[model samples]
Target: MKLFRSKQANSLTELVKACQKQDHQAQVQLYERYKGRLMGICLRYARTEAEAEDIFQEGILKIFDRIGDLKKPESVDSWVKTVMIRYAIDYYNQVTKGQKQLISTDYIETEWESDDYQNLFSKLHTEVLLETINELPEGYRMVINLYFVDGYSHAEIAQLLGISEGTSRSQLLRGRNLLIKKLDLKGVKQHEKF
Candidate 1:
């Protein structure tokens, strides 16, 4: 499939093939296609726009550098996201190395999966919710993103972040509590306890 200037790549198979061959235009097209989505993942992990841009650039490079390793073009969207998520975790690990953020072990009795909390959380504007979660402490933010947003299991999160499963659970709990409290402070919730 020729990446002609007048038209778009017609299929994922074609795009992946051209990208694997280092076709510049195809690479640009790939970049353009996933920029918003991949950058959203980066921004969710990063504390600032500058940091998100840095992560986004790094992820794109990885995507380009390893595009040939992608065996199935049909899964390109998910594969690209996986690449970005792994890179984000690596970035997190590097930043947090040897700097253990102290975490409070308060065990809040809350069914995080219950519909009540989900409805409560859903009430906030998307921007407000993301900003609130972003402002959480590093450990809290990382675990929350991994578990809540990315659908990673606690065990998977533990392996990814190089922490114990218990630590993952605690971090997620703490993060959730902190996020709820922050939401409360913002007048999103008046008498909610979790």
Candidate 2:
């Protein structure tokens, strides 16, 4: 088992090819290789680790199911990431379906990076920051994850989540404020920045 575990780290191209052919061992290896990355992506969008696990499990299955269609084995990393993100978006859409709050307003741009906050950020840890972000309201969290974490523009997020650009901007602003408040409340206690 130890040797197999070590072996899984080598030969990603071969791993992907074997996975494409539905080899069960290779499939397991592929999962082992990408599980942390897949789960990290899910965690950014999810409210809790459990929810992230649910998304991670679903995304992994989806990734394998479509692996056979992969054109470039070397590109599997990005391919899997794209699929996981899309699936997370689907999960968000389905969960937020009837409860969607469309707040239409001109973009409210507030600078979160004040000099005071910059000092705090310099001492903050990644886990603490992620926890703070996760504490945001569902809509706010989703928009924050999409826009900042996932690097999607407001227009792109609006299109992806079927919300208006104004709404996306609104959510992101609200999310940022909430995150700042949370961070302010929880000052750095022997914490070091990531």
Candidate 3:
């Protein structure tokens, strides 16, 4: 059975193999191939572009250090993504360690119909939506990104963030409310349910 058929897969397999053997050129190739996508994940977690760059660099270094541990070369993209996200989460936790009180215990209730919001969200440009998400407070942004964007469940988010599930739920709720408010302020009208 062949592991790689496409040129892209062959390239990826070769790159991973070379990286495992400590080939510097292969390391560079791997970084170049995935940097944009990894940087986008970093940006979702980072408050600033500089912070995202730092996370990206750190993740790349970790990837090079652990490239040999990867059992499946075909899953390199997801492995790289996981490494980058873990790095970003660690960075976020370190930066906000002293501000733990910011995770609000009080959950705010908002009338959020997913179907309605889906319709509303479909109308906004990607950049506009991202900007609105970025404007959220750090904790809120993290929960929102992990839950909504990254497709992690509340329990998964709680574990990743070292918080209780209830806290994760609260943060997600508040984050959604805040996003809706910001979108409304930006003149994004909610679709009226018939």
Q: TM-score of each candidate? A: 0.83, 0.80, 0.83
lDDT of 1 by residue, 100-138 (tens): 775555447655566656666666677877888888888
Alpha carbon deviation, residue 32, candidate 2 (Å) = 0.6
Model 2 misses residue 47 by how many Å? Answer: 1.6
Q: Write the per-residue lDDT of candidate 3 for residues 32-123, one digit (tens) a residue.
A: 88777778888888877888889888888988888899988877877887777887888888886457455443345667676866666666
Tell me the whole-model lDDT of each prediction, alpha carbons only: 0.81, 0.78, 0.78
Candidate 1 similarity to native, TM-score: 0.83
lDDT of 2 by residue, 1-194 (tens): 11123333347788888998899999987898778877888888887898899999998899999999999787777788878988998988887555755443423554665587887676667887888777777778888887877778999899888889998987788777767667766655534222
Give the total clashing residue pairs for model 2. 0
Worst lDDT window (10 residues) for model 3?
185-194
Best by lDDT: 1
Report residue 151 deviation for candidate 3 (angstroms): 1.5
How are the candidates ranked when ordered by lDDT, highest leading?
1, 3, 2
Model 2 scores what on Cα lDDT? 0.78
